[model samples]
Target: MKRRWIPGCFAALLAFAATAALAASDDPSYGIIAKHKANSAVRISDEGHRIVYGSPKTPVAVEAFYPLRAGGEGHEWVFEYGYNLVTAFPDKVRFVAYDIATPRGGEVWQERGLTCGAFLINGKREVTVNGKKLSFLRSTTMSGWTFAQLKAAVAAEIARPRPARAAAPKKPARPAKQTVIHVTVPCGLAGPYGEIVHLFRARHPEIRVTTAANGIVAMLNQLRDNKMTSDVFIALGLRELDDPAAQKRLVSGSITPIATIPLALVVPKANPAGIHNLEDLTSPKARTVLTYTPNLSGGYGARQALQEAGLWDRINSKIVTPKVPDQCKQMLKTGKGQAAIIYSTCLKESYLPDKPPVIEKDLKVAQMIPQNLYSPVVIGGAVVKTSKHPAAAKTFIDFLRSEAAMKVWLDWGFTRLPGA
Candidate 1:
C-alpha cells in the first residue's frame, strides 16, 4: 500500500474553520471540516483538539489521531488511526501505516478542497521544507509511505505552532430503529468491502452492516453447523451457491449475480523467478501455490486454468498447495510462496478506469489468465434463510444489484454480466 497516489493531488487535514476570538484561557476546540467550496482556508492553532465535520450524513466518529511526542527528545512520532496506534521514529520505519476507509465521493471530496483543523481537505497546500515535499494523505483511503516522507510531512504540519496531529474522520451515526445485517464476503474483497459497504450504509443508514471476510468453505461449514450467521453472503463463484451445503442455508430465489472475475497469475514486484507466462510454472525451479480449497474459488479457478492449458499434469509437481492459501499477495511478497493464481482484481493497479494507477506497491500481475483458458468465475450473493431480518436482508441483496453497487464493483475491476 505504498502511496505514490497523490503526488500533485494532496488531501491535507484542512477543513474550514470559523474564527474563535482567541478563546478565553485558550479553550481547545477545533472547527468542523467539510469543505463547502474552494478558496476557503482554515487557521490551525497548536492546541490539540478534535476537529469536527458537521455533515449529518457523516457519522460523529471521535477517533483520535492527534500527534503525540514519542520520547522526551520529541524525536519519535505516535499516530493513532482508529483502533491501531502507530508509534514511528526516523531511524527505523515500518512500511504500512494507514488503514483506508472508503472515501465519500472522489469528485465531491476533491471539489470541496482543503479545510483546516488537523489537516486540510479538498485543497492544495503542499509544504516543501528542505526540498522534501510534504505528503500526508489522499482522503480516507491511504497508502504506504516512507519514513522520510512521513517525517517531513509530520515536521511541516506540526512544525511552527506545535506538534503534528492527524485527525481521523468519523462516520455518522445510525438510526435507533436497529435493523442490522451481517455480511459475509471472501477475504480478498475485504479492502473493497470497506468502500462498498460504506456506500450501502450511506444509502441505507437504518441498516447496520457487520462484515466478516472468510472463505466460502469456512462459511459453508459454519452455516451448516449453526456456528456462523450472516444475513448476506457475497460469494466468489456461482458454483458455491449451487453446493448442497450452501443451498440449505441460502434462499434459492434470493441468489443474484454480483460480478465476474477472471483468474490472474501474480508475482512479487522483484519477479525473482523471472516468470512471464503460465507455461513457466511447469519448470522445476518455479514454486507456485494453488489454493487447495475449491470452496474458496480462487484455487478452483487456478486449477481450471492449468487444466485448460494442458499444463496441469506437467506443472502439478511445481505447485505448492497449502491447506488454506488465503493470502496470495502476501505469499508472493514474503517468499513464503513464489507465485499464485488469484482473482485478477484481488490487488489492482487501478480501482476506476479513469483514475490514476494506484498500483499495489509490493506486487504485480505477471500474466492474466486468458478468459478462454477456463470458464471465468462469477461472484454471486444470496440471503441466508435463517435470518430474522429477512426483509432487510432482501433489501441489502437488492442493493447489491443496484446501479450504485455496480459502480463500486466496476471501479474495483469487476465486469458486468453481458446480458444482465
Candidate 2:
C-alpha cells in the first residue's frame, strides 16, 4: 500500500480529534502515572481507577478504556470501557478475563475487557497485595490477557483485612516475573518485514516482541538515539550488508544476510518526467523530482550511489524527499513529483488487487547507474549488543536466515543474499 498522507477535511479532522478525546476519557484517574510500574510494567494513576496507563508500544497517555467502580468499592459492580484506535496506526488490544474471590469467600466475581497492557480503577475499595496497598473504585477488565490467572491473586489481596506494618513503609510489590523483550520493528504497512519479526518472537516464548513501522530511516535513527533497544534489526538487505556504521555495531561476523530488495526508480505510471537514465535527470528539462529523504539510512545509500555516479547535483536540483517509501510513491501518484526512486518490490506489490494510486509498469526501475556498484540491497537481521538475551537474540537471527524463514522474506520482495 503506497502511504499517502491526504490531509483530512476539516470536518473529518474534528471528528478524529473528538474521538481521541473521548478515548482518553475511558480511564479518568488523574495523577502522576508511572510507566512500567506494576508486574505488567504499566503505570497507573495514583488514585487507581484500575485503568492501566501507557502504550504497549511507546505509550503516549493511556488510551485504552477501563471504567472503574465509584470510590474503589470491593462489592460487585459493573465496569466497561471502549477504545478508539488511531487511524495512523493499527491498534490491537488483547483482552483478558479475571475471576476473583475474597479471602473470606464472600462471593465469586468476574472482570473482563480488552486492554493493551493495563486497566483503570475508579472506586473507594482498597486491597493489599504483596504488601503494597492498592485501591479499586471502579473496576474495568480487559480481554485476551495471557496471565488471566493473576487477577484472582489480586482479588484475594483486596478482600483480606489490612495487614499491620512496622514503622518502615511497605516494600513495593516485586515487578512481574520474566521481563518481556521489547523488539520494535520498523516497516511500512505495505511491507511484511515487521510481521516476520513477530513470527520469530512467537516461536520463542521466552521473548516478547513489539513492532512499529516508523519507516526504515526513522527506525535506524531511533536506535542511534538510544531511546529504545532493538534486540534485532529487520529490514531490507541493504540495511544489513551495506551500512558501514551498522556493520561496525554487529558482533564480528554476526551479519546474517537473509534476503535482497532491489532498488528501482519510479514515476507515476504516467511517465510525466520522461526519465530515462542517469543523463536524463541532469538535462534540466525534468520538472519535479522525487527520491528518498536524506534522513533515512536507506536514502543515504541511494544518495551515495548517486554521488559515486556524479548525479547528486542534478538530482538534488529537483528533489522531493518523503520520509518513507509509501510517501515517496504517493508524491508521484498525486502529481506532487514528476518522478520517484523506490524499491522494486513496491512495483511488484502495486500489481496486487487494489493496486496503489499508480500503475506499476508506468514507473520503470531506472537502469542502475554504473551497474557495477549496483546490486539488490540485501535485507536481514542481527542481534544487537545492547540486548539482554544475547543467546535468544542470536537464536532469532539464525532463525531468520534458516530455510523456513527465508521463504517468507523471499516472498516479501527480498532476494537471496550473494553466496547465501
Candidate 3:
C-alpha cells in the first residue's frame, strides 16, 4: 500500500527546501522597514525613499522622509554608508552611517549608525531589516550589493500598505528665531576665518555670526574682562588656553585646533635690498620688519625660526616691530622695510594669484621657514561657557573642522590640521 521514494527524488526535494529557506531568510531592506514599523511617528510611503550610490572609496548617502501622522508634516532623514578605512573588514567592515533628524522644529538629533542598520556583505553577507536579521544566498553572496538592487528592494517593501492610525492633536508652530554668535580671533586668522564664517552662514542661515579680529593678547584680555561680546574665542596657540581666567571662560573639553600658519618672509616687488634667503636678512641694509615678540604669534614664530638660523641677534637691531601681520606686509610694500617676517598667509600674492591688483601688488613671499627649524602657529577655538547662543557657537566651531572649511584654510595658504 505504501510506495518507496527514489534516492534522486529525495535529494532534489532536500535541495529545493534549502533554496526556499535561504530565499526566505534574505531581506535586504537595511533595517529601514523594521525601524519605521516600530516607531509610531514614522510614516513610510513609496514617494519618501531615495538612495544614492557612490563609487569605490566614496560614501553613499540616502535621504528618506517619514511624515508625522499628527501634523501631516515630515522630516528628511539622511544616512551615509561607506567602507571603514581605519578598521578593516570582518571586524568593522562598513563606515557607521548616521541619520540627521529634527525631533522638534529647529532642534536636531543624530541617530547612531548601527541602530539604523548596515549592509555588510564581506566576510558575513547579512542585511538587517527592522529588528529582523537576514543573509544573502551563498550562491549570490558578494562583497557588496549594487545600489539599484538595494533601492528596488527597499522601495518594494515600503510600498506595501500598513494599518492606519488616528491623528493626534497638532501643536502650534513656533516662529523661527535667528541666533547670533560672536567670534573673537587673532588678526592673522582674518582671511581663513572670513571664508569659514561665510561658509558656515551659508550652511546655517538661521544662525548669524560676527567676528572681531585683534591681537591674541588683546583678545584674551578682553575675554578675561568680559569686555569682548564674543561667544567663541580662536587663539594662536594652546598656551592661551592655559591662562586661568581664559580657561574658566571656555566650555569644558571644547578646545579644538583648526589650522596652522607657517612663518614666511615678505619682500618688496623690486627686491630693493635683494633679500632672498634667511642669511640675506643679516646684511646691514636688510631693514627687516618683525612682529613684537611673545605677544604676537607671528613674531614669536619668526624669532624662533631666526634663532634656529643663527640670525636672530643680527636681525634684532634692524627689526621694526609691526603691530600685525598686515602691518608687516605694508612695511615691505611701502619700502619702509627691505624684508618683513610674518605668517605666510599674510601675503595674498603667495596663494591668491588672481586677487585684485590693489591687494596683490608689491609683496612676494621671499622665504618660508622650514618646518624642521620652526613650528607653524596653531589656530584653535573654544566656545565660551557664558555664551547665550552656546549651541550655535558649538555648531559654528564644529563647522570649522569640516572639509569645506579646511579647503578655505588651505586656499589661504594655511596648513590644515590632520583629519580635520
- Each prediction's TM-score versus the true structure: 0.57, 0.49, 0.53
Determine the C-alpha RMSD for candidate 1 after optimal superposition of all C-alphas.
17.0
Q: Where in model 1 is the C-alpha error above 4 Å?
A: 1-178, 215-217, 349-358
Q: List model 3 lDDT by residue over 26-86, tens digit each.
A: 4223333344335433223321222222222322222222211111111112122222121
Residue 326 in candidate 1 has what lDDT? Answer: 44
Please give, for residues 98-215, the per-residue lDDT of candidate 1 as tens digits.
1011112111222222111122211323446677554343222223434455445544443346345468567566587879777765545544555666678788888877654444
Could you tell me the lDDT of residue 376 within candidate 3?
A: 56
Per-model lDDT? 0.53, 0.45, 0.54
lDDT of predicted model 3: 0.54
| Model 3 misplaced regions, further than 4 Å | 1-175, 213-217, 239-242, 349-359, 418-420
Global lDDT for candidate 1? 0.53
How would you encode candidate 2's per-residue C-alpha lDDT over 1-420 as one tens digit per residue? 223444446667889988986755442321112212322333233222233333344322222221122211121222122222111212322221121111111011111121112332221123345665542222222121222222433335334455553495675553355434443443332234444545665676565443322345545544454533556666554443355655555456666666666555665555656777656777555676676665443465567667777878867767667654456765666677766666666654411112222225445566543434454466666766677776666777787677877776676655677777
In lDDT terms, which candidate is top? 3
Per-residue error for 17 in candidate 2, Å, reads 26
Q: Output the better candidate (1/3) by lDDT.
A: 3
Query: What ranking of all candidate models by lDDT puts the best one first?
Result: 3, 1, 2
